[model samples]
Target chain A: MTTWMRLMSNDGRIVFGRVENSYLHEYESLHAPVPTGAVLSLRTLTPVAPCAPGKVVALWNNFHALAAKLEKPVPEHPLFLLKPAESVIGSQQPIRRPAHYAGKIVFEGELGIVIGKRCSNASLDEAEAAIFGYTIVNDVTAAGLLNENPHFPQWCRAKGFDTFCCIGPAIVSGFDWRSARVVTKLDGVERQNYPLDDMVFTPAQQVSLISRDMTLEPGDVIACGTSLGVGSIGDGATVEVSIDGIGALVNTLAVSSGEAEAAAAVEGAA
Target chain B: MTTWMRLMSNDGRIVFGRVENSYLHEYESLHAPVPTGAVLSLRTLTPVAPCAPGKVVALWNNFHALAAKLEKPVPEHPLFLLKPAESVIGSQQPIRRPAHYAGKIVFEGELGIVIGKRCSNASLDEAEAAIFGYTIVNDVTAAGLLNENPHFPQWCRAKGFDTFCCIGPAIVSGFDWRSARVVTKLDGVERQNYPLDDMVFTPAQQVSLISRDMTLEPGDVIACGTSLGVGSIGDGATVEVSIDGIGALVNTLAVSSGEAEAAAAVEGAA
Candidate 1:
């Protein structure tokens, strides 16, 4: 299995790299990965969110175990949601809670499929070929906001907040996901431990089906829906999303102060 | 009113321009506009989507008329969804029907708010200040897919296909949106004609509330949702989404052949 990552070098330049042992061999782009021979110690570089995805497509209720637990009927097609690219944050980044939202922040550990090529209306074979690698995703959601309004369910707003999507550490290609498992650790306690095979739709099926609905561009992530053990994370708590072959993605939750202050802080830090 | 547009110049480059009568005076950028003396006939330039938005934050049931018609409660906050940037197509582009979806395609005409600044948890005043201009959005959806799965509502997939979002012709600033109306035409017959004042959440309120959930970046669009006349478009049907101040966005629907063929064709064409 090959591991890939995008990291900020000691010189402060963001570059793609193929991780081997404790060294990072730099590459120009993820699409056509070829090492540039600019090697660095993994400790010397800061890991950023690996993929600059055009969009992060997340599934809902695509897990057989979750459906059974919720007592809901299995869906024929993959029901999904789009989390804005702005919601994505790398491992070690703080998951800033929206200042206006005073709700339960839930951590959902998911296996993410990274699309390697532009795929639309693709067959299962083509879809399988399009899979670049796999990564771990913490699909964070404001639980209170989901059903606050009786008229309409606020799925997007409840989950599309900034820093709501925590992904990375590395993308692992050629990993056997069938026997793999997703484990979510909240504040050092194992909260979720589910088999990847519990998914109602397999990775190939998801990629093919979703590609038919929309164009899956290079680097776009399709988060295979989470199973059980989905629970809330308190403010200042640590959440870790882990898939064995693909390393763990860890983030801390922090409630924002307010409008001007948080906005000013985000901009200032940028 | 100042009309802004992104048009394909004679040199095949997409550039921003200020529209005045039949002429387009080129601008350096939309945020801080400066005329660049590169004037061309509006007829000579091909109008593309007005903005390259990071995300299209679209509302659902935000119109009072629609809520009343459906006997649904008026939402206190704007219930929204994110349409990927890939779905966006410029005026006159064809809306490609997904190969796997043999469903009804519907046209939703709505007023689109184009944001001018990066805003997070913004106040009404700050939201109002961030409003760059107004445009028309054709929030297209695969109507049949919306409720095919009983367990989950397919909002994102139903509306996120490539070329599902059609917007542009122009973005008009300093216009009276309160008095304006959205008019949708399918095959030259007007189907939807609803007043803009029927919105449950005003543009300012939507911006402010939505910004609290996620940052609204410059050029990002907020589709205010549709009212009474939302219906389906057949294969090869022409649909037009229009607003008085923000011109019209016209598109044609075409059914895809199949998976391998369509995927190969898309890749070849690209």
Candidate 2:
């Protein structure tokens, strides 16, 4: 198994690298990475999301445990929504509260499947082959915005604010997700502990089924929806989503501020 | 007023140009385009979508006539969904039927707001300044897939098929949209004729309000939702979405084929 990460050097150069013990061996690019043989300490580099996905195809009610609890039947196909690229943020980034929304903000810990090849209407084999690696995703949402109007469910707007989709630490290739478990902690207290084997649709099945609806491109992410433990996070509270094979992704909710000032803060950080 | 278009030359060179009467004046780029002094006949170039957007922020029930007809209240804020970039197709491109879904495909003729400046939580004045131009759009949908499940509404999936979001002909700058009308023709028969002035939210209001939800990047598109007549299209039927200032965007629905084969054909064309 190999682990890959994207990071910024102290000089502000973005580079992809293969993670080793305590160092990152640099690479030229993520698609066809070539080793530069220059190793850097992990402590000296600032980590970013492993990949820049064009869109994040996130599933809903895909876990058997979550479905049973919510009284929802197992869906025949993957029920999903598209999160915009603007919602993405790296681990250790702040999950800012939207300026206009003063409602509760929730965090869902999920396993993200990273696409390595462009695919549409792919077969089971092709779908499995298209799977590049796996990463951790904190699908943060403005809980109140969803179902605010009885006529329409605002899925995209509720979950698509800046820094709402947190992904990182590393993308692990050939990780055994079937035997792994996702553990989420809020303020260092365990809130969610679920097994990945309980997923109704496997990662390959998700890719194959969803490809029939829309094309999945290279670097596009499919967040395999969360299970069991989803709860609200208060301002300045820290949330960490971790998997055994993949590393932990930690982020803190920023203090609520006016909409314009919050937007400017995020832009300034970008 | 100026009109801009992106096209493929006979030699397969992609260029952005200013549209004149039956000719194109080449430019260096879409953002900060500098005239290249190369003129080409319109007949020699193949037109593509005016701009490649990272995400298409689409509004729902934003038209006053549509809400009044359906007996739904005018939403306080823009009720919207995100259309993936993969779903975008330029004018003249074929709208292929999804392989897995054998259902009614509907066409929605609407106006599109193209953003030139990056903005989030912008003021109304800032929003107006950020608007780059306007174009015509056919927000196509798989009518049956929507509300397929009683619990979850598949807005993104039903409306996000490959080639579902058809845009362009040209992006018109400084066009008078308030006095214009969106006229949609189905196989030479007029089906929709809605005045742009009936919109519940103006273009600037849309930009400013949506900016609070997520950042609008340059080339990002906000498809103003359709009104009045939205109907299904049969195989090989032509659909044209036209505005007075923005030229007509014409497309044809391709005959249904196997999902894998259809996807392969699209990839082959790409």
Candidate 3:
């Protein structure tokens, strides 16, 4: 007999899905290697950042559409960036941009790859071993700094605020790439949707390409570029990013914790 | 009594004043703090790097003169950066720019601060406990991609290659910054020479500023800014960055290791 955890019902029987009017850890099971006819529940949580001590490496735009928008050549290699770990929030947390930012907050829906091991000049085969799991990340942005400083040598300060990067739930290992689907929903309407395999560089290739220049340590998460349907999102909009096999991550819009607490109090009243 | 090390003659007698050229280790001591009024000599081959391994954090133009050269704002707060550790080289090496690099090498002389303790969100006084000592670094950079891209974000490919970052000697705990100085010489031409106290932010202040946003780990190195009289050197030139109290760090200029090796062979023949 195998032991699996599931949410419970009022009568004490195990519940296979979400419980009504409460927070209960609900889950389903599946075969490791599925046949074409096998069906699995889409209840897995959105992937959160796995790094505890590792630096957050963010890529600008390794996508074809974004490249076309900028009229720049798609890079032969991934352009790397550093976002200090201080900027991360959980999966269901509100994406916050303080009044000081005053810039538009844009969302870039990306497939986040979590590193499982320490690596330097790693090979493609070695990179596979280092991948702990995968998740979806809404790579939030301030969206106006690029235009403000055309001559700046680096952009760490502009992109590095306390809540610039958000990730969550747990990591899902054994993530297969073929036919994976990703969708972004805004206020209950689907805004962007695309296939995971549409990327110019695959996850394995990104790892191999990046390790040539920088050494990747354990718990490092690399966010592959978002697909088409990416546009700016203003304040006060609920943004949910979902993957086919993985569950949906719905986070509301709020400027600060004060606003979030006020909204929570209103929900309790109703 | 404490047993200390000093450079010794081939016959085992202690060598004084000048370090025997033949006895210098093959590896370079790229960036290391110099003890005030002490001649630094390696008694044992200890590997030294410009910054510690947690991440090579650099502050862009913590001094005003550098911000003007790049035509950037003297940042309201300290500007921080990550230079890949792979770029490090020892003192005996020359800064290398290969044919592949194609005239992309630039030099930045910074006072290197070595962290001895783990600290995060540290206050001004807390920063003092985190610092182990200081060193000097010639932050050698590759400019083509960085100049071509929106911002050269890849310090690994641009500045993190082998031998690109240099340091030296051993760590010395105490030095009065009020009277400290830094000097840079290219082909012995003396391009930059300035007092360390002339920095826009002090070493303790830089550490304190970073800790407010980051949890600095041990072995993490910080490169404080270079002074005025900065310029480029490559193809073939000897570059030296020296700090008063710290020993002189000398490296010949080529674009990279292959070029450095070829230059070395040519110099060997002469």
Task: Give the alpha carbon lDDT tens digit for every residue of A1-270 in model 1.
Answer: 999999887778898889999998888788887778788888988999989887899989988889999999878888898999889999999999787677789999999999999998789999999999999899999999988987667788888998999889899989899999999999999999999998999999999999888888999999898999999999889999888889899999975566547679899999
Per-residue lDDT over A1-270 for candidate 2, one digit per residue giving the tens place of the 0 to 100 score: 799999988999888889989899998766676898899998999998999999999899999999999999989889988899999999998999998889999999999999988899999999999998999999999999998998999999999999999998799999999999999999999999999999999999999999999999988999999999999999889999999989899999988666557789899999
The most accurate candidate by DockQ is 2
The prediction achieving the highest TM-score against the true structure is 2
Please report how far candidate 1 places residue A71 from its true position, in Å.
1.5
Local distance difference test values of all predictions, in order: 0.89, 0.93, 0.63
TM-score for candidate 3 (chain B): 0.74
Model 2, position A93, has a per-residue lDDT of: 88
lDDT of 3 by residue, A1-270 (tens): 111112223444433222222333343321121123422232332323333435666776677776777777787777766665656665677766654456676776767777767776678998887776676677776667534544444455554555666664445677675578778888878888877766777788888777765567666778787767766666778788887654565666575666567789999999
Q: Report the CAPRI category for model 1.
A: medium
Query: What is the C-alpha lDDT profile of model 3 across B1-270, one tens digit per residue?
Result: 111112334555432222344243222222232333444445444433433455677776777666677676666556666765555666776665543456557777778887867776677788987887776788877766564555345544576655677875434457565587778888888888877766778888888877654557666778887768767776777888887766677877754566668789999999
Q: So what's the TM-score on candidate 2?
A: 0.94
Residue B197 of candidate 1: its Cα lDDT?
94
Give the runs in model 2 whose Cα sits over 4 Å from its true position.
A36-38, A257-270, B258-270
